[model samples]
Target: MSVTGGRVPDHHPAHHRARGRRGGLSPVPYVATTTRILRQLAGDHRSVAMIVVVPSAIIALMFFMFQDAPRRPGVPSPFDDACLIMLGVFPLVVMFLITSITMQRERASGTLERILTTPLRRLDLLAAYGTAFSIAAAAQATLACVVSFWLLGLDTAGSPALVFVIAIINAVLGVGLGLLCSAFARTEFQAVQFMPLVIVPQLLLCGIIVPRDVLPGWLQWISDVLPASYALEALREVGAHPEMTATAVRDVAVVVGFAVLAMGLAAATLRRRTP
Candidate 1:
């Protein structure tokens, strides 16, 4: 028992209650976690290359493949039509892979369990991760937009700024989905497997191979619910129009809604200890 002001207070009920209270949500843990993640990402050279270099390389290869393909009069070239979708796709895919695998590693290493033992709330941890990766996602989007427009000669009727915004949103969507999926995985290999399960169907059905409307009716219904479908639709809008259209706004809203829902579910899945 400790003495305070000549009175012993260690056994007091108020002291017991104070000790029993869980930590309140605060910005301190959130900011610290975000900073820690950003620093970790910055220090990883391979991850840096994967995030910053790989997507641009893929886009350049696409540019070369379609550079000489003929376009019918008054019709945009195939690459011109497809690359805008790709701008968002590459960021989404890359961010998703990086995030899921990284988070899974944390689970395997027991870092997440240790962090949860402290006063930090699950929302703080997840939100910090989302925010940290969103910053990286913004950087990735900016670089890809610059390379696609200036270096590779990709053309679009919409403002380059709008394309960047769509790309960033897609990347953030990936981050949210990745975090959600990671909770279901026990290993990095399992996390990688989720990509095919989650991403491939969306890619195929998101009007990448054919206009989504022409797909089988059930496939069309599935596409309607996938965020990638709307992401591509928004890209198509930006490519075909100089100003944002009502349809593009709706498409973006859908993607943002999915991102928010995924994050909330991921928070729910977070545990102080995982098997």
Candidate 2:
């Protein structure tokens, strides 16, 4: 029974030599699942345009509108921090729009049932969608950041790394929220309807048009609960300031909390359906 190094003999019936070949085949499912989702995304032109074009336009428009705004003495330039904040928010909008469409389209065509019958897990489905969204969102965010920096001549005092991190987290949070919305949405129309409710409140409360500290007590409390609020704050602090602080930690925690909570909700909803 013993072989070299005291290992069990491969001659055992249960230990078929062919089993070694199976290890190479295990990755097939992962590759197949990834390719299937990518192909699905590739076939949809509207989704591609939505993810790529709309967010870019929004970021460009905001940059032009605010590029010349005057900065108060002893304050960071709006061109620098404001553009980045918009970059963070832009991805959220894109993800929301796309997620709504994705779920609604599947339900409309009754393709969701067919997908569920496959070997894919609920988490896998969620993850595949998230992966596609993240790739698109990251591209938009990066392009916006670069174009804004060049056009506005904005400087983050050489803290490009910090800006990149904040932008990515913002994109991830957006995609997570999108998945959660898609899970509960009954139709594409209903999902589209959720955008204003999900996006506009963040726009007002995220300190883009108004200073957070100057808001009324209750409004400030509401802003405190928003994911965009944390992203905006964290980005401003890291981009404009000379050093990091405990405040950065708190802000990051808030952003991460939002991403985790939204993704969890989406996964739970997907798991309840018959597969």
Candidate 3:
């Protein structure tokens, strides 16, 4: 259509092809970014000890305290069940703490802003953070449980594999929520403060100390909306009953759904540069 052109080419084909592509979430950037984060974390021994070693040691101590408690021939003691639940809760707490601080540090250091200057999308950064921490969380869950059951002689009705899976889900939930929370913090100290605002309430309300049913109606309804409630419930069900019941499956689904929601929220709130 141009005056100097012998012929004009239609752009419809290119546009049509681009539109035909699914254009869903991409894996290339996510994988590369996750690999880099994991490599960086691997070099920090103190961080490694805090994440994987300290929790296991605490659980081992709990086992030592209850090692001689009397129990039924095939059933675990009440303390054992509590320990099993802690195996899930500890990882969730640690992952949330570590992820929030890491994200805040990156933001403070301008690393996240610099990375955004490249081809990385906000979702890519969230995914990488989630994926990398999730792997570390899984390893921690496995090691903690192995040490508890084999070395410390801890007992639970659930299969060890199921506990591991639930722990991983809880940890991922932590990671996603941590990333979302980091967006609200102006400093790393603010991120640390969130443990009380975000986690302590969940711990108290998630039936760790008391039964959710026995709480007031208002309290029960509040627990209904918190992802930790479902996670703790799932852990209790597996630890006490060791069955893949409908309730257990539903709880797991809700926990995972919250994780996805948190990650989506983080991505939505992300900015190309600091405001």
Give per-residue CA lDDT, model 2, range 1-275, as digits (tens): 55578876677754663463343323444456657766777788787677666666666676678767887997777656656676677777777777667766776677767776655556666666677667777777677767767655657653666776677777778878877777667777887888888878988998988999999999999998988888888877877676775787799889989988988898787633322
**Residue 161 C-alpha lDDT in model 2:** 64
RMSD of each: 3.9, 6.4, 3.7
Best candidate, lDDT-wise? 1
Best candidate (score: TM-score): 1
Global lDDT scores for all candidate models: 0.89, 0.73, 0.84
A best-first ranking of the candidates according to their TM-score comes to 1, 3, 2
Cα lDDT of model 3 by residue, 1-275, tens digit: 33375644456565544443335545777799999999988988887887899889888788777767788887768567868878879988999989988898888888998988766677777889988999999889988988977887766677878888999999999998898888898888998899998888899999888889999999999988999999988887887776676888999999999999999998888654345
Deviation in Å, model 3, residue 96 alpha carbon: 0.5
Give me the displacement of residue 243 in model 3, in angstroms: 2.9
Model 2 scores a C-alpha lDDT of 0.73
Model 3 ranges off by over 4 Å: 1-22, 70-75, 272-275
Candidate 3, residue 119: how far the Cα is off, in Å: 0.8
Candidate 1 per-residue lDDT over residues 129-193, each given as its tens digit: 99999999888888888999998888899999999999988998999989999999989999999
Off by over 4 Å in 1: 1-25
Model 3: weakest 10-residue lDDT segment is 16-25
At residue 214, what lDDT does model 3 achieve? 98
